[model samples]
Target: MKKIFYVFSVFVLFSLVSCVTADNNSKKSADNSSKNAAIENILNRKSVRQYSDKKVEQEKIDTILKCAMAAPSGMNKQPWEILVVTDKEKLEKIAEIAPNASYSKNSQLAIIVCGDKNISERFWEQDCCAVTENILLAVEALELGAVWCMAYPSDERVAGIRSLFNLPENVIPLNIIPIGYPLTQEQPKQKYNADKVHVNNW
Candidate 1:
């Protein structure tokens, strides 16, 4: 009877370990799939200037904004602020100020990335840039269309945006992103250059 009891205990232990190993392998497979999905999304991203008239859902806009905030910042300053503009008049006005954003008129909405001067003024531009890239990446992931329009480093453009948005003196607009459904199918450019990579030392 004692021998039988010991055998039963060993069987149970082996079963538990097998189940644990299977669970761990399943988790690893899931993680790898998720990682590949992200890479695929990044590789497929393209700058879309023409957009269909279809209006972007607020839920998707919220998701894009959430991803923008998730961008990494220097010293965790997180100094970025996002403005979602859906008004037609305002969109037109934006195009007037920055010709690079002329596509904004056709897009259902525009996202204005801003940075606060108080949150490490020296690093605000870099942080805001990261946020803009995040917005673009998220747009691609969501199968939406968008393009990054220049707003900073141009005094005239900055002044025009400031007046249009009534921005405070401390807040600086970084860029304008016009987003909607693509009107035409576009392909991502092959920009990777193997020669640029240097291992260990240049």
Candidate 2:
């Protein structure tokens, strides 16, 4: 019965190979699904100024802040301080002080991203920008709306925020982001520029 034994061995080997192939294919599909979800989240991000009155959950706010901290910092300086404002009076005052960010008056939450010169003297602005971007992306992932208002580089906005918050000498406000549920639906735009891309060499 040598032939019978040989046939059984071949059959078992073929079955094992098929099972392995199936498992690998399943894992690959899962990986692709995760990648696609992340890409979609990036593409679907849109600036939303108007917001619903519904308050944002504290858990989502914490998650977004965690993502902000996860941003890349030059030389690992990691120099960003965050401020969360939900008080109506403070938001109104901010809106008055920063005219361009009038949306803050109606927002349920406002986040102020700050740079600490004492921590990373040279790269604070760039690092704080990364932190702001992470905050926006995380907000989008949580199905919340947010719009960023420039704070730094503008003497009026910067000084206004500094005086309002009583920030120390080394602290600088970078941007103000108002986050909440969307009042008006907006779609993401395709901003890819072929002329702006250089491969290997400019």
Candidate 3:
């Protein structure tokens, strides 16, 4: 009887340990799946210029904006504002202002990432760039298409955007991104360049 009781107790303990291990392994698998999805989003990201006619929903746009605002800023000043345009007429106006972004006319939504010099003068550009990149990645994760069109540093394009939008003197438009369903699928380019890498010394 003593021997049988000892073996039963051991069996119960082993079963409990096995159950705990299985639970931990399941949690780890879930965590790994989430991590892999994020990495895939970054790896497969591609510039998409051509877009289908599907209209983007307000909720998705809001989510993208949330992601953009989540980006880290200098001193956490977060001096960026996004102007989302879904109107056909307004999109056309932006296209005229930025010839390189003529694709905006085809997209259902256009996001203008602007920097407020009043918040952080010197770091505004870098902060805004981080926000723009977040939006791009969020768009990709959502299975949407987007193309970043340069607007700043160009006297002509900057002036045109400012004048058309009637933006304040302190607000400077950095870039325009048009988002929608992709009409063309593109493969991600491998950009791992060991030649440009320098460790400790150039």
Candidate 4:
């Protein structure tokens, strides 16, 4: 009787340990799946400069704008506006402002993302930055090429864009994004550096 009882107790303990181990394995698998999805999306993103001259569809533009608006804003004050430019003549004029941005002239569309300074000065840049990133990612997901060009902080450039678009005085230009179908394939960038990541104490 004593032997039987001891054997039964050991069996119960082994079963409990197995159950715990299985649970941990299951959680790890779920975590890994989530991590893989995020990594895949980030790895696939690339900054495309060369583009085809084909016009971007209006529905596609709307979808990209919708994605941009979904970005989180500071204090929930979404104070950003987007100006879409499709006219070839206007794009040429705008391209002249950035000497290095001759590629803008060939893009199918340009989006001038602006921030309303009247809403919250503390988060104006942050809000606009979030929206710009969203636009870039959305364009990439849609198999389009987009190049981000800085506009804010440059008084002359901001003024030029504002005057060109007849924007309100309170609206501030943040970035100019040129979007279109990619003419050249984007190569993966090898930018990872293990030295950049620090442990908990670092």
Q: Give the TM-scores of the predictions, in the order they appear.
A: 0.89, 0.91, 0.95, 0.79
Candidate 1's TM-score: 0.89
CA displacement after TM-score superposition, residue 125 of candidate 2 (Å) = 0.4
Native-to-model Cα distance after best TM-score fit, residue 95 in candidate 2, in Å: 0.7
Error of 4 at 136 (Å): 0.7
Residue 163 displacement in candidate 4 (angstroms): 1.2
Clashing residue pairs, candidate 1?
A: none
For candidate 4, which ten residues in a row score worst on lDDT? 95-104
- Each candidate: how many clashes? 0, 0, 0, 0
The per-residue C-alpha lDDT of model 1 at residue 156 equals 92
Candidate 1 has an lDDT of: 0.94
How big is the positional error of residue 139 in model 1, measured in Å on the Cα after superposition? 0.7
- For 156-198, candidate 1 gives per-residue lDDT tens digits of 9989999998998788898999999999999999999999999
lDDT of 2 by residue, 1-202 (tens): 9999999999999999999999999999999999999999999999999999899999999999999999999999899999999999999999998987889999999999999999999999999999999999999999999998998889989999999999987999998998899999889989989999999999
- The residue pairs in collision within model 4 are none
Stretches of model 3 off by over 4 angstroms after superposition: none
Where does candidate 4 stray beyond 4 Å?
A: 1-38
TM-score computed on alpha carbons, candidate 3: 0.95
lDDT of 4 at 38: 65
Better of 2 and 3 by TM-score: 3
